[model samples]
Target: MADRKEQDALIQQPDAEAEAEPEPEPEQLTGCGASALCDPRRKPHRFLVLMLMCSLSFGSYFCYDIPAALQTQIKQDMKVNSAQFMQLYAWYSWPNVILCFIGGFLIDRIFGIRLGTIIFSCFVVVGQVLFSFGALLNKYWLMEAARFVFGIGGESLAVAQNTYAVLWFKGRELNLVFGLQLSMARLGSTVNMNIMGPVYDAVERYIGVESYYCLGITFFIGGVTCLFSLACGLILGYLDKRAERILHRKSHGTEKVIKLSDVRYFPLSLWMIVMVCVFYYVAVFPFIGLGKVFFEEKFDFSPTHASAVNSIVYILSAPLSPFFGLIVDLVGKNLMWVLLAVSTTLGSHCLLAFTFWNPWIAMVIMGCSYSMLACSLWPLVAFVVEPHQLGTAYGCMQSIQNLGLAVVSLGSGAILDMSGYFMLELFFCACLCVALIFALLLYLINLFQGGKLNLSTRERRKLEDQSRS
Candidate 1:
């Protein structure tokens, strides 16, 4: 133990030394001055890129939760049990367990970010089309296959999306950018939660209540959103390419590339962060996937009201994330924020499991906690890993997160089938308990190693400048 602590102390010194080194200044603007409207270095142009990057995953986010939005309808129309219904989400996650890493690697090695983003967006479009057709034909097996395809593009696209954010926004407004991305993603989910039910009803009204037909039409409409995202991906690619040309920006391909063997050398804090990501999200996402039905069964809510309650988490997230990001940026005790998120989430689950108070209160608490966790947690990876390895590192995080979500989603369904909502909530509480412990371990390790993870932005900047001098 003593030797291990000494080794970590040795590692911390070099890590700080590496971070303290000064970086090259940006290349001079060529075609236009920095203040020009069309200059990529200008705030407006960067904001445009940010907006497009945020929208890149909006379609996938909207369609991914369609099954959950219309859970009761899907089960009844498709004639599948709870476990079978959850298989929609599970299949989406299963492929990502491996494919997301490959996708990230391709971004780093094979395809540059621009091409990678486009290809993954195309995959999302194709998968959504197939999924809609499967529903139209009432073929459950076909829908599952389509979900597998969608998962490949969906999760990988997220990796591409993160890389773009870091590439353009890092060290300046990364936390806010990540927050905005999460907000947009949650916005898509929230829109689907509230809109799908009404869309289904409208289709049913027009087509005289053919169950599978209405479902097919509803999902097909959702596919339009995916198409919109693909358009954004194309335009964003063009803009990024143009910016690179104008600025004489060099690609990371010219630098030391990420290798498979690099994973073994990742800091211990990175692994601990990954553990927190896996355990914390397994509780939140699986619950959301199954929450609508739980609200209906427990609170006796009508489908619309139940969906409204179920979607509160997303609704709150959309508005709260940017605000929380600003806080994390200013405060910068990321591990503390994570611990708070886990603790609040655990409390929220306990309230639902043990009490009969208004569920809105519990959901609201959970929602804010989720926003904090996301904005704080994800940006830590950029801080810990090298810029060249960001794609691979983000991909690894998503892959492991998907694995947890896939397993727990299926297990949550079975627990619902076998035990009931109370037991299921307890299971989630247990997961949060595990997450909280990991978070504390992370805090203690960082403290012993040098306390870099807990430093506020101002202090971090001061430390960097001092080290450089």
Candidate 2:
């Protein structure tokens, strides 16, 4: 121990000397036109700008899910059946899945986040106006069209948020920021579930009739919120411009080319990870869409009571995500956590499948399963992908996941109609089983391959040492 301490002291000696060395001449330091006395301790104003951007992005993206939560109310008001109501959810997801990759490319190459945010905000605004009209006039086709267009906008914003977070927050509390952003969005979903019911009730009472007035108001508010988000984007663009100028002057205007080949494996691993994400969401999100109605019908509860119970999942999920992220960062082994989370999720589904139970008890168990999966699974993408490719990888994953959700939503609706019961729960349980099998296969592959993917040599050494000890 003494020798090891001496060796550590010796290793740090050179760095101490370097700090003690004489300062360079003023001309040598000042040639780049940057201040030598810039205080690293002072916080950058850019962080504040980025936070606002993230908040706005969260608000806009969440509007996509809000409509789905209010589906039954919308259907009853519009006099449409469950099949037609389900199509609205499909419209919201389908365009996003189809155009997600393209959104990523545009964000990385042509538009960057500034133009992308603005362009996408327009789509959201236009879609909201059309949706508001449909709600007021009881035009189902128009509502579906609005949902499709809104999805394009929301998908672009989703990609932009992930990309922007990677660019602006890398190596500086990135895990915390990612978790916080996600939690905020889930908070939006929580709010939608809990508050929308009361709001809809009030709106229906106020409109002098029982109608889909709340849906119209919700879309209108979303449109206005999007405009606010666009303004935040403009501010972020300005700050980015200022930061770029400072960096250029400091680096003597030399352009740095980051080689994409160095990160090729990142994208490859991300593709497999996205497949995992798709299966996970396929097993989960449709249940979220149908949760309230299913619980109400299965257990004979009021709509408000059902929604409140379902809201527990989102509420519990929001706060737990950050802790899960901290665990991943601290442990530095994502695969084990992924396996554990998926295993627990599978068990939860199996329990739900095999038994008939009270709605509250079932929701609690489902919420726990979803919380584990939601928090643990997403951070794995950051582990597998390069920092530069985060946007593309996240976008690709979102696209695939959205596709699965879209298909499952439509199929589950048809199945529910045909089977004469809410069969989505069983179908989703089967999907979870498949996901568990895939997770096991991925684990075995990593085990045989010496845990090379995502794990650095140092990390592997630590794991091996821990095992031996």
lDDT of each: 0.86, 0.64
Residue-by-residue lDDT tens digits, candidate 1, 1-469: 1111211222222344444655345567645555565678678888888899999989999999999899988999999999999999999999999988888878876787888999999999999999999989999999999999999999999999998888777767678899999999999999999999999989998889679988998999999999999999999998887776565454212244678888788899988998999999999888988999888889998888999999999999998999999888887787888889989999999999999999999999999999999999998888788767778888988999899989998999999999999999999999999999999999999999995888888988788677646
Q: What lDDT score goes with residue 116 in model 2?
A: 76
Instruction: Residues 179-224, candidate 2: write the lDDT tens digits.
Output: 6666766777787677666767667677666366656775565556
TM-score for all predictions? 0.92, 0.81
The ten-residue window of minimal lDDT in model 2 covers 1-10
- Please identify model 1 stretches exceeding 4 Å from their true place: 1-36, 251-254
Residue 401 in model 1: lDDT: 87
Candidate 2 C-alpha error for residue 433, in Å: 1.6
